[model samples]
Target chain A: MKILLCTDGSSYTARALDLGVRVARKAASAVDILVVAKRDREEKARQMAEKAAADLETAGIPVAIHRRSGQMTEEVVLQAQAASYDLVIIGGRERRGVMRLLLGSPALRVTEHVPASVLVVKGQARDLKQVLVCSSGGPTSERTVRFAGRLARALGASVILLHVMSQLPLTKSAVLDDLEASAEELIRRGSPEGVHLGRMLDLLATEGRTGHAVIRRGLVRDEILAESREGQYDLIVIGAHITPGLNARLVEDLSAAILLTANRPVLVVR
Target chain B: MRRRQGKRLNWRKPGLALSGFLLFTLALGLMKGGAGGLTPLLRNHLEVTNAADSMGFGWLMAYLVLSGSPVAAAAVALLSASVLSYLQAFTMIAGSRLGACLVVLLIGCIYILRGHEHWTALTAGILSLLLTGSIQLAALPMGLLILGRGWLDGLSIPALEGLAAGINWGLEPLIGPLAAFLPGWALFVAGVGLVTLSFRLFDRALPQMRLERTDLGQIPRLVYRPEVMFLMGLAITLLTMSVSISVGILVPLSARGYMRRENIIPYILGANISTLADTLIAAALLGDPRAVTVVVTHIVCAAIISLLLILLAYRPYERAISNALAWIARRRNNFALFLGVIFVIPVVLILL
Candidate 1:
């Protein structure tokens, strides 16, 4: 696997490098260290790329450095798209006040526009141990499950497949039939959500990993955050919320919320 | 072959559209001609003395008919005959909407009686009614203010006069014979029947929509966002010209586990605002420019209140509604108590 690691010489970026190195070494992946800076900050950007590259090299991973000067998110997106990299890892700053609400961070913007999967390293980088994969059982869910399964296998982490049933029944029969039914009951009945979860489990097994399927009922983002905190997962995996066509940007992205609110690293599958 | 199929005109659509339009115009002419005859019944027997009484009257009338547009149209007809003040007309229109939202609930009740779970069957309808009720009640003061100030009295559509005249000319032949035999009040009743029939025809004119699970799976989750759902409700109501049709779609979707309660509140909010489109046509048909302004006031006030709810307090409002739904569904008596309160409010208002 080929991975692109972007940095800007900040302490946050340094942590991102640490996580990137660990992931590259686990997957036997080659790393391309990227530094994007303003026109006047070329020297600083090059220095940061070299430092990240030197660290990756010492870890016995093949590494190359690429330095570019332009708008940070645009440049990162271009670099990710220019090559067929499997994943792009970047550092996410802890935004506060209005910044948190606006969510204009370069890390998030790259996740939205970039062509490949993104692993946004926020807060402290830690050893990969447990991974939480959020599945909506929608059409794009298979890709998310498969990607997270592969990541878990590579990192030797335990996988928890979490499906949040946020749907409220419109009829009384539905409540009596399914809404209040627990995950085990749903699986027994072979309900759609259950079947989807079963399929996800099968995918994980194919990736040489056994995953635990857990279901919770509530708001999607809130439940995912609750599970991540309670489970103490090292990484939160979610699908890239890409809506096709002209009104693509009009829809809300749940991954964006999980990325902003989750305390640990988040991997957005594209 | 695919391009050819796409280009097919499906003449049935235009045919139905023309039939619906003709029925609507004929219904309006009949109602206008018969409206003057109902003043005695409205004044002495019904005693619709004030705005509140008329509001209750409209509300109760909608309950009897299982629809709101006809009641709203009747309010405009009364206003055209000078039997109701503009404020009365506005409040009556508002009241019709509050009562109209219950049609979905009633549909849910039928499902419940068929051996479905009571709570799930009724929650969507209950939520829809609650959302509509809150926004309409909040819009009341502002709507009354707008009509009371006479700010929109001069807001006339010049084309309405010409349009009404042409329709009157076309409809006179069929209406003349009925007018000769029927008393004024009876003519009004017949006109209302015609109005109801016209709406049914219009409903038939709309394209049939069925949301399969496969289609829903492809829909992005963001489509459930408050703003997007708001626009969807608005657009669908605008097309269907009936809140009953728009909100009614929620029942089957939710029952099948295709839609969520969280996603529907904003949709109901949006549906409430544009559901006034049919009443606006009724006002224009009345040919009293002030009648149009009356309906417009209700529409504008509803739009503002709904927008505020969506913008300022959507998350909180959604939570509050969810809580209310749970509370109502916790026991059978609570739901019964809710029904009793809703039923009694209109009676009390009419008495007031």
Candidate 2:
């Protein structure tokens, strides 16, 4: 896997660089560090990129560094789109004022716009261990599950697939015997959610890893965050919003919400 | 063969729709004629002299009928009769919406009685009430500001005058005899019943809520953007002309595992704004331009507040709602406290 690590010479980006190096070393992935600076800050940008690259090289990971002078988010997005990197890692910053209220921080914008999967490093940096893969059971989640399985296999981490059952039939008269069933029971009955869970587990098994499926019924994002908190997972993996067409903005992007709110690192797969 | 074909093509929906329209028109006429009688009761007995009191009155009235649109229509009739001021009418309509969410709660209670998990059965209703209560209440100050500035005061629809005149032409003969025989208060009581009946007929005319799980297969099982859900809520309510019906469908959708708490918030927000379609029609029927403006104020304020919440502070707002849900679900006492507070606040408003 090829990984792109983004930096801006900040302490936050330094933490992301360190986390990126560890991840690349564990997964045996090649790394490229891209640092974007303001028009006159090219020297600082080059220094940050080289430092991040040297850290990766010292870990015995194949590393390359690139420096660009432009808008940080635009530059990072351009590089990610240009390359065939499987993942783009960046550090999240606490935004304030109009930026926090209207547009999110540059890191968040890049995460939302980038084509590759984004791993937004926030809060305390930690090694990949317990992984929480949030599955909406949509077709796109198959890719998220497979990608998470591969990442887990590389990191030798335990995997937990969480499916939140938040929908209820509109009327009481409709038979809800199946809805009341547990995840285990649903799997036994071959219910759609159950079958989806079974298929995801099988995919993980193909990656030479075993994963447990857990079901929670509540708000989708809340349940995912709650499960991540309860399990103390090192990384939370979710699928990018796949609301195609003009009405795409009408759909909530759960991955973006997770990135904005989750205290730990979040890996959003496209 | 022609007769058989005629019998085969269903006319029940169209027939019910015509009946509902006639009933709605009749209800509007009755309420307008009798609204003056409500003034004394409203001022002396209910003591709904202030905007807050009128809002409380509307809220309690919705609780009495288990719906809000009728209460909102009542506000318009009262406004037309000079019984309630424009601001009072606006707040009353807002309060009716707060009370309207109870219908969803009642549906959730039925689910619980039928042996569904407490949170699973109640989440849609709880979130519906929460979203409606929060967004409407937050919009109240802004609505008041808009009214104060007289922003929509001059807003008028000249086309409605012809419609109102046509309605008068059709209903004058029926109302004249009733006006002579019935007391004003009695006419108002009868009007309320007719309005409720009209709503029932309209609901019957609506497409049946018999959606199969397979029918929703194309709808992705993901959290929709608040704006998308908001528009959906608006569109559905506009079609059904009842927030209760729109939110009621959400319960079944949620029960079927096709909706989430996050998806329903904006949906409920949009539903609340458009649920006033009946009230808006009532305003037009009364030929009171200001009545139309009052309802328009609520709609405009609500749309602005909902959009701002979705765009700017959605994460924090969502977190707050989720935390409130957790608190309610954490203990039986918490739920009881919530229910008690919702009931008590309206009474307090009336007393104030």
Candidate 3:
């Protein structure tokens, strides 16, 4: 497998670099460190790439370093599309009003168009400990599940599946019964989500990965963040959902929101 | 969702399916024409002294074939031919809808017997029948009153009338021979068969429901928004032209384990509304402008009740339906008894 690491040279970028090195060494993947800068800083960018590459190679991992002077998003998209790189790793930065709008993070857009798996490291995690695979019960989560499984197997870590249900119709506890019916009619019934969860559990079993699932009936992002922080997970694995139709904007926004709010490393598998 | 392209047929042109639709329309038109000759014989056998009796006949008719559209179409055709009163036809169509929903529940019965979870398999089918039956039954009284007042005469679609006209005239070469040679009942049967065949072909022509993209892979989540699922159901039914196919698609998807019981009702509500399109074709073929009026009446009545449910009490409605189905599916005895009761009531309605 070949992996590309795109960085803007920040502390978070260093953390991403470390994670990338560890993954490449463990999985025997070839690594490329790419630094994109405007023409004036092109030479500086080359020095940064070569230095990062030297450190990775000294750790006994194969490495290639390249520096390009162009737009960051365009360069990575072109490179990722032009080649069948197994995974692309990028570090996310906290952006304010104008920077966020004009430069509007490339990771969000890249996940939308690119077919390759992406891992966006949000925080500094030296090693993989506990992993959280966020699921919306959609098909795109298949890649996330498998990727998490491989990492867990490789690192001997545990996996947790987190599902959040949104209560928009009525209060989650509310039920409608006939006002006129006798007491004999009132028997307790629960939602049939168990059958669906059974299937999801089967998906994990088929992958030869054992996992425990936690369900929360609340806002999707809030619940996921709460689980990640409470679990003190080292990494969060979620699908880079390019949601279809009207669901696209909402899902993409949620993905971005989760990426920004998460205090731990986030791996967005496509 | 990226529409996964198929290997063979360009769903783009759909030339063959379009031809199948034309023939299907022609078949329905022929059925209308043939039904005209069988009016006396049908009136002799299917005639009922009261509305309840006619409804029972409708139930029996739909039960015979496990489809509601043809039976509803037949009722409208009989109305156009003056073989049955508007009240009789309205009640009968309601009964046919009630009976049509049986197909899903019946399929669920097989699932239960095969050891699948009752809540997963039967909920969709039961909710489909219950929703359609309640709305249509509720719509019947107002429908009869509206028919008596003749309020819908101005509401006819000139374009639809013309389309029906063009079809009948164009297909005379084919229909005339069959009409001349075949007995009336046979032609009616043949028309029903062709209508079913047309629907089957149309289903073949639809974009396959890729279960992988359905998102049920992660959770059997219900669409909390009733309006969205309602429109989705309407759109899917319009495309398939069969309520069973619209609802049946959920079965295989649910078997893969992701559809919620709450999602079933509104989808059935939408499907039940558009499932009347084929009946409208049957009514149009009769050439009585009033027959088209009757078809519209069916559409309006259903749409009104459905929209009313969606706007006013959709949540409670979904909860009640879900709770009731769960109660019924909770035990083998309850399942058997409910099955016996549903079957016995329609038979008793006919006997009464």
Best by TM-score: 2
DockQ of each model against the real complex? Answer: 0.28, 0.36, 0.02
Candidates by lDDT, descending order:
2, 1, 3
What lDDT does each candidate get?
0.79, 0.81, 0.69
Residue A204's lDDT within candidate 1 is 92
lDDT of 2 by residue, B1-62 (tens): 99887765458788998899889889988998998887788999989999999888888898
Best by DockQ, which number?
2
Model 3 ranges with Cα > 4 A deviation? A1-270, B1-8, B11-13, B113-120, B209-219, B248-255
Candidate 2 - CAPRI tier? acceptable
Worst 10 residues of 1 chain A by lDDT: A168-177
- The DockQ of predicted model 3 stands at 0.02
List native contact recovery per candidate, as a fraction of 1: 0.47, 0.42, 0.00
Model 1 CA lDDT for position A119: 94
What are the per-residue Cα lDDT tens digits for candidate 1 across A168-205?
55544454456666766778888877788888889999
Q: What's the C-alpha lDDT at position A258 in model 3?
A: 78
Poorest stretch of ten by lDDT in candidate 3 chain B: B215-224
lDDT of 1: 0.79
